[model samples]
Target: MDKLISEFDRALRTVFAPAASVRPHPDAQIDEPAMDIADKRHAAGLMRVNHCGEVCAQALYQGQALTARDPAAREALRSAAHEEVEHLAWTERRLQELGSHKSVLNPLWYAGSLAIGVTAGLVGDRWNLGFLAETERQVSAHLDAHLSKLPQADEKSRAIVRQMHADETAHAETAVALGAAPLPLPVRLAMRSMSKVMTGLSYRL
Candidate 1:
């Protein structure tokens, strides 16, 4: 019952509470370049996708934390979730700046990611960490793709993406250092496939 309540509280916070950041936004005080309609639309779409990704991150970390048996592992997961709140806050602000709304299907994304995280946690600590490592690695690479695709003059978005990429790299490294095992090739492939589907949908929806 306690766990159920905790999860309910987390869900409420994630979906409704205003997100606050511990660290200043990467784009804080940065002057934005004048963007044409095409560039602005493209940037907004990408940032919206990024925001959706952060929402999924919150679900994944919180789900894993709830199920993690090891105290240290649970702490690590929760800490990661806290850090991800900053990402969520930043992306939310960026999306507003770009005059775009979040993905309409965020609830679905959160639910699916939470399920995945809980499944991974049930597999044991090593596999749980492996899943996180793989997730952060994939996200880092995804940020790279966004950086390349962003308009050259969009320095604010670029700064935010670059910082996010760095943070994700650190998260993956921390997971590896904590003894994350390599996932099976098939699992990795499946994760990639799912990510592709999510990104495709989030881009437009």
Candidate 2:
């Protein structure tokens, strides 16, 4: 019960934590101020999407980690969670710089994702890992698309998105190496469709 309570607390913190409480960016190279208003708005919008993704990541990892029985599988989930901390950090910093807000519906998003993760875990470890693999694959591709759409003048946002894309790809590959079963085409399509809804709603809402 204590372990579950601790994890629940962590999830709440990660999903809705104050931006000011997080640590400074590991690489502070992109901290310079810019005078472009349009560029800043564009960056803010993109950063909000990125922050939403991290919120979902926290819920997914926590749900899977809580239910996973195998030590190895749990470790993988934990490792992905750790990497997502960096993503959370980067997006938060970008939002702060751009003077934009994180999503107001973050707790709702987190709860939804956590339920999905728990459902996936109850199915079996392989299926849970399969879900992770497919999710990361889709997210990496989405980040790639975001890179193309981000305003050209927003070099800081571009850099952050590029690195994030690479990290997501790595996460997907790692899940595969850890024995993630290939998902059925129907499952993948369904996942993609649901993700599309989330991404679209998050982009402006």
Candidate 3:
């Protein structure tokens, strides 16, 4: 019951509260570039998508940690989730700097991702880790895409994205080392499709 209560509290904080990061902001040293209105809007859109991604990541890790059977697996999920919270803080700050709001659909994204994470956890640890590994892999690729799309002058956003990419890659490698099985091609494809839908809608709404 205590664990359940804690999870509920975490969900509320993740979706509703402003996030706090332990690490220094990635762009703390970078000067805010004098971007024109269009570039500012574009950068904000991209950062919004990234922010929503971190929100979903929080949900996924929490849900997995809730059901993961192995103690080590649970710890792994929890550790990754902690880092994801930092990502959340970084992206949220970036969004504010760009003068934009987070996605209105963040709650929906979190709920759906939580369900998926729980399902993955119930499938056993190997597959559970596989799911996490795949998630990070896709997220790394997505960050790379954002790095390309972000305005060159917007080094603040780029710096954050680069740090996130490196962190995600490390998370994926950790899962693999912990005995993650490879997901089937069909499952991978389905995951990619869902990601596409989320990104497409999140970019504008």
Question: Please, what is the whole-model Cα lDDT of each candidate in the order they appear?
Answer: 0.89, 0.82, 0.95
Candidate 3, pairs of clashing residues: none
Q: How well does model 1 score by local distance difference test?
A: 0.89
TM-score, one value per model: 0.97, 0.91, 0.99
Q: Model 2, which residues run further than 4 Å from truth?
A: 19-27, 31-35
* TM-score of model 3 vs. true structure: 0.99
Best by TM-score: 3
| lDDT by residue for model 1 (18-76), tens | 68898999999899789998998899989988988999999999878878888878877
Candidate 2, residues 11-118, lDDT tens digits: the string is 878876753324345436765555488767766877898889988988998888778777888888888888888888888877887788888777888998899888
- Give the local distance difference test score of model 2: 0.82
TM-score computed on alpha carbons, candidate 2 = 0.91
Stretches > 4 Å off in candidate 1: none
Total backbone collisions, model 2: 0
Least well predicted 10-residue stretch by lDDT in candidate 3: 58-67
